[model samples]
Target: MELYGLVTLVGVFLLLALEPVLARNPLHHPRLDRWCNNIGLAFTNELIRFFLPLALALVAVDGPWQAFNASSLGLLWGALLAFIIMDFSLYWVHRCSHELRWLWRLHRTHHSDLDMDVTTSFRHHPGEVGLKLVLMSGFIGLLGFTPAHLLTYVLLHRCFALWSHSNIRLPEGLERQLAKVLVTPRVHQIHHSAWQPETDSNYGQILTLWDRLFKTYLSPDQVPCPARFGLEDFRSAEDQRLSALFAQPIR
Candidate 1:
């Protein structure tokens, strides 16, 4: 857990600092107030996810509710299975958040940001945070995952997520190669597209496998460069205020 915290801290620090310098285009959100509110909200949501674990099965999995135990498959194989499950589960949850109306309301808080950058990665609503945490924690019990397995997954998934959401411009060839397996920033930028169809595509989390397998993959080349981000309804600058964003789901 300590390592997980350290990795997360480092990931956030490096990307938040680098994105502005390496940004492909000029910085969009110049308002300092919006930055403070967005970052503050993100911090609160991250705390909930890091601190709450009653729902996560970090101990023995002898309970009768166990559906399938991967421990029988050996440590390496079980760990592999756990990693795949974690990635794909995140894919479905993200996909469903778009398809399902209520989920979209919560998820839209993330997309509602008119300006997309590394900090946008941290702009998820508390509702979405709690929802994903509750859902993702189920894998530990069902798959017989230990604390170490989950902590490792947490570090990888979260760091990759921050990276994918970042605005740093990667070289075209390198970005293309990485996007073949992992969800690179270019690929994820399409998912953040303001266009409805594009927004519904590229639903992968850590890996692009799920999106390709499920036929939701959309190539970055298919969309305009720096695809327009944010939702149509929340386009105004004032809508991005901390209070408006916090109350958005109900509105």
Candidate 2:
């Protein structure tokens, strides 16, 4: 798990470096301070998870879950089923984080970033990470997903999170077609809009199907173009500081 996590981290950074050179979005202006704060948050989150009991629990139960596999489903079919269940579970978890005020306090940290980029993907609060682990553990245990299935899903989830938050722009036609199935950059950008209505919609992380099925999906055309990013209430530079973000939930 540690090695896989390291590889995913490296891949994310590589994509971060390559995106601007390949297809940059003019709206995003990267800043050193913002990157530092974002990375700091990610480091803090990793530290928190490392010490959490949930991490140890996952390791201990991994082998047992595979050994007593009650599901006679074939490997390929089981993996696909697990992936869909995990994605669906995450959709509700994410949406609840917005609808519930307590969850919103922790989740708001991610939306406070004025500039969206690959680093923005790691800007979540440590509290939010812990909460997600708690929620995900329930789904993983209930669905009886194997360790291999969990690792693959985690890698794919991390990659897509980076891709969705990236500043690279795709051709309009292609982006439109992709949004029909997956959560494209344009679709995710709308979720970061400063406007409350736009921000509340498009809550899916990897698949667009959840939002569409739940009637929470909104296209870029539905809202103003070049939608303003970040929380309107916390737009100051000071609000993005590492210390400030760490204390934001209680504030």
Candidate 3:
């Protein structure tokens, strides 16, 4: 578990370190730029506030499949099953985070950045990150998943998320075909759009099925918001961080 955590954290760092090459344009906001100054401060505070509580919750809980004694083959299959189940769970979690008000508060932190890139993936408020960990961890325990299995599932999803954030566009025809299986970059991009219709749609992360099932799916062509990204009211990037962590709009 610790090893997997290290790998995931390192993956985030690698994305941050390679931001220049991976981003579509030069990154619009620096990690410590003037506009994002409050963002970093809030991030540090939220991490301390949330992770400490989350750690205690996880320690008290029993992980899934904690009691099973199985053969090596069984373990492999168990892990595979675990990954699939977790992916489904994450799909719903991501969707709900957008639909619900409180969850949206934390989720907004990640979306505040005008530039949607891999670094944006890690720019989440620590509180939001901690909440997700708790939710995923509980789901893991409830599903009887092993630590190894959880780690594998986490890595796979992280990779998918990074892919979704990439600046590269998918061929329109190809993206439509692939959305039937996994989420394409085009499909996920709609979720990042600052437009009202676009912002509330395309809630899936690794899979597009949930949005389809829930009727939240919107095609890039039909709801084509091919305009500048980011919130309309918050014009300047300076307040992106402030609004993200502490001042959610009363809409």
Candidate 4:
């Protein structure tokens, strides 16, 4: 699991470096400081996770209903089922983070970024990470998923999270087709729009199916205008600081 995590981290770092250089309309504003702050926040979340590494394992169920057990549904089918279940769980958790005031307070730290880049995917507040860990552990335990299933989902989840937040522009046709099945960058950028309604939509982390199923999906054409990313309340430079980001959930 640790090895896979390291590989995903490096892959995301490479994407973060390459995407903007390939972007057609990359932000002209200076991003170094914001990138540093976002990375700092990510590092803090990792530190928290390191100490709480067993949260998922501890909550895992070992009963007869273990769906992912090799003797039951078989490893392949079990993994696939577990992945879909977890993805669905993530959609609701993400949606609640916006609808519920307390969760939104922690979530706003990620939305506070003025620019959307690969690094922006890692801008989650530590509080949000803790909340997600608790929620995800419960979900995993309830569903009887194994360590391998969780690891597979984590890799795919991390990849999509970074890809959806990338600054790179995809070929129009390709992006359109991809958005039908996956959550593409164009689709996700709308979610980060400073406008409240847009910000509240596109809550899916991996599959776009959940949003479509829940009627929360918003296509680019559906938007009234092109989105200006970031939270209106956190537009000031001072609010983008690492210290301010950590304090945002309470303030």
- Highest lDDT: give the candidate number: 4
> Where is the poorest 10-residue window by lDDT in model 2?
62-71
C-alpha RMSD values across all candidates: 1.9, 3.0, 4.8, 2.4
Rank all candidate structures by their TM-score, best first, as comma-separated numbers: 1, 4, 2, 3
Q: Which runs of model 2 end up more than 4 angstroms from their true locations?
A: 22-24, 27-30, 48-71
By TM-score, who's the top model here? 1
In model 2, residue pairs whose N, Cα or C atoms come closer than 3 Å (at least 3 residues apart or on different chains), thus clashing, are none
Which regions in candidate 4 have their CA more than 4 angstroms from the true location?
Answer: 50-54, 63-71
Better of 2 and 4 by lDDT: 4
Off by over 4 Å in 3: 1-73, 171-173, 241-251
- Tell me the spans in candidate 1 whose CA falls farther than 4 Å from its real position: none
Assess candidate 2 and give its TM-score to the true structure.
0.88
Number of residue pairs clashing in candidate 2, backbone atoms closer than 3 angstroms, sequence gap of 3 or more or interchain: 0
TM-score of each: 0.92, 0.88, 0.72, 0.91
- Computed on alpha carbons, the lDDT of every model, listed in order, comes to 0.80, 0.79, 0.63, 0.81
Superposed on all Cα atoms, model 1 deviates from the true structure by an RMSD in Å of 1.9
- Error of model 4, residue 131, in angstroms: 1.1
Say which prediction, candidate 3 or candidate 4, comes out ahead on TM-score: 4
